[model samples]
Target: MVVGGDAAKEYVAGFAAGVATVIVGHPFDTIKVKLQTHNTKTQVKEYKNAIHCTSQILRSEGVKGLYRGASSSFIGMAFESSLIFGIYSQAKQLLQGETESIKPQLQVIIPSAAFGGALISFILCPAELVKCRMQVQGRDSANSNYVRYAGPLDCALNTMKSEGVKGIFRGGFTTLLRESIGNATFFSTYEMSRHYMHLQLNSNSSARSQQSKILSDVGIGIISGGLAGMAFWTAVLPLDVAKTLIQTAPDPNSSRDPFRTLGSIYSRVGLKGCYAGLGPTLARAFPANAVAIVTWEGAAKLLGVKRD
Candidate 1:
């Protein structure tokens, strides 16, 4: 029987893992976003490409700029990953039942991921808002006189001052849609792959061992994470593109209709524009999710969680 106490413990452990992950990976994430969402005609040719962009950021903004919005990322991840792993584990346990015979199949995994994804979206939206704003700062159109926000706090305060609390949640609905579907694909693919790997190993008794299990776990995690990220972005690239526009739209007073916004994006850049951020997203996902899944599983083991 999965108790509330178990769920709480899992949440805390997941939160710790999330903190560790963000610390290590947030800088890369910031870079990825900047590169993916680079302004169209900035004279800052230093950022005209990825390598140049990275070096320029390092040279100009120092290490701190690489980690801009990291604090908000930590806050967002704490709630998002914690709830995701916690709910995912609990849901898996509930659906699969406390039995060793439970086979990892889409039936049990997909819904669990879907539920976890929905829960994480609520936590991800606001933090992501802050992260995007921070990443794009100082790079806005030079001709414009937009107020410069110093950091995450300033962004938040200024957002509230100008647009009220609701401003802070801009694009939250699209965020929810993207993350829910994206993470659903993420966990479902991960669990299904892990199960297949374990099953293959177990089928050959000679291959069944602790080392094999560890290897299988890591391999499945990497493959699944990468594939899932690809699947996610491909499936919802349009929504993601729209979300980015809504969150970073230069003019806050611009029309807020999602359909119109999506249409404008499509017309301006064609379908390819919708997938502008795929490169960085894939790069970040490969490592970030590898760390996330391995850490979550390792912590679960340390906590003596057993599949039953």
Candidate 2:
């Protein structure tokens, strides 16, 4: 059975699941982003791999360092995921017939997912700004005059104290671009994968009758979500690179325009630099999205949502 409701329940469940995923996953996420956006020219490459980076952060900064910006990450993820899932679910229902059979054209699902992706970027920008700051603070402190933020609250308070509320949302436009485009690709990819999986299962002569569909959905969801995550990072690599630059770029008092800073990055690194963080981003996306799909499906079932 698939879940049914107006937008409210979908949003709430998405928010809850997103929050849970962030709390469990943000530490790795932070590390991943930091590695992805690391300034090799300036910052010394400390750890060899992701595991090494994690251990180094923990050793130097303590466990808290691993969980830096966890609070803001949760808040940002809650809003972003809630909005994305809500819009996706509602859009899916609107686009397709309420039938058990998979739809033939995967293209029909893309617009709905794209719309959801665009909408959630608004909710995600500020929190993502803070998250980027926290992730890069260790490196920032090494070269810049910026005082290190202890955690999400510290980052927020400092930004508000110095730059006001606007400071907190500085890179919202870039975030919107990244999330919206990324999610459109993500959802479209996921739906297509799911459809393909369903088709394969249906064609199998010895497929189990009672559990085949359920297993297929679960398998498809996992693969699709992971693929979507991969597609998202690949498509939005430049935006993410720009976002990191804007977030970590020194304040105006330091006499650097954020735009110019980003331009400098582009000039120096070119396309390759823009994709600096793809490796870890891809690593984290698979399990994180797998968990998200499982949770969403489980919740829908628990709530008696009738699946077609």
Candidate 3:
């Protein structure tokens, strides 16, 4: 039997997932954005590596620095995850139709996941734009006059007033590309891993008691989700690096085309430049997404969403 629930249930579960994500992942995300934006021709590299970055943030700005733009991310990710999970569930259900197979087909899963990702990009872009800008601020310690945003809302208002509505969506296309491709890889890997683990663990899982089955599912979900999270960053860190650069550029008039910007980065600094922040990103991926999936599953269960 296919595992799923009504769209509303998935949305609620996904909100829980998103919240878990930000809490576990935001510190790593801050390091990733800072790494991506700082190592450029025009700017002096502020961090030698993820360790250096973490230490610097700790010493200078305290733990709060690592969560600079978390408020915006919390809001954005809650809505984004809700929509992405809801759309993915609904689309997969629609695509599967009357099919009775418990095993997920890539043909159905990839497109469904990608479609959800593409749709959520619209919501993600502005929130990320604000988040990136906030994350990258305070780097210029020498400039005593640099004014930081009071908060997420203040940052958004300032961006809108200065760059207009378009400014809020500065790196939208990059966000779209990243989400669509990354999510396709993400969900596909999770489903495939889950299926493999299910087969290996139980020749007769269905015969197990409800509690045993739930426990098995939770264990499998945690591993699969972690692997899936790692897979996502491995597939798209270069694109993510490009997205960060585009969103956090000091010059508003800078090129916004992600591919072209990536090309520029490649020309200037080669492959390493395109893959900036790989360390913290991969480190953050496994635990963050594992928690997200666990939370999601727990929420779904609490809400009485049905499963296999």
Point to the candidate with the largest lDDT. Answer: 3
Q: Per-residue alpha-carbon lDDT of model 2 for 1-308, expressed as tens digits?
A: 12455457676667766866786577777776676556433434544567778787887788888777778887888778778887888887777645544453455467777788777776677788788787777734777544688677888788888888777777777777777678778777776776777678778856576686677668877787778677777788767777776766566343224355556766775655566666667777777887776666666566555555
Mark the 10 consecutive residues where model 1 has the least summed lDDT: 39-48
TM-scores, all models, native as reference:
0.85, 0.84, 0.94
Clashing pairs counted in every model: 2, 9, 0
Clashing pairs in 3: none
Q: Output the lDDT of residue 105, model 2.
A: 45
**In model 2, which residue pairs have backbone atoms overlapping below 3 Å?**
1-305, 1-306, 1-307, 2-305, 2-306, 2-307, 3-305, 36-277, 100-308
Task: Give candidate 2's TM-score.
Answer: 0.84
lDDT of 3 by residue, 1-308 (tens): 22543668889999999999999999999998888887754435668899998998888889999999999999999999889888888888889887877787999999999999999999999999889889988555456322368788998998889889998999998899999999999999998999989998787554888888889888988999999999999998888888888877767899999889989988888888888899999999999999888888889878888765
lDDT of 1: 0.71
Write the residue-wise lDDT of candidate 1 on 70-137 in tens digits.
88999998778888888888887788774545456677777887888877776787788788888777
lDDT of 1 at 8: 73
Question: What C-alpha lDDT do the candidate models reach, one value each?
Answer: 0.71, 0.70, 0.87
TM-score of 1: 0.85
Worst 10 residues of 2 by lDDT: 252-261
Q: Better model by lDDT, 1 or 2? A: 1
> What is the lDDT, from 0 to 100, of the residue 68 in candidate 3?
93
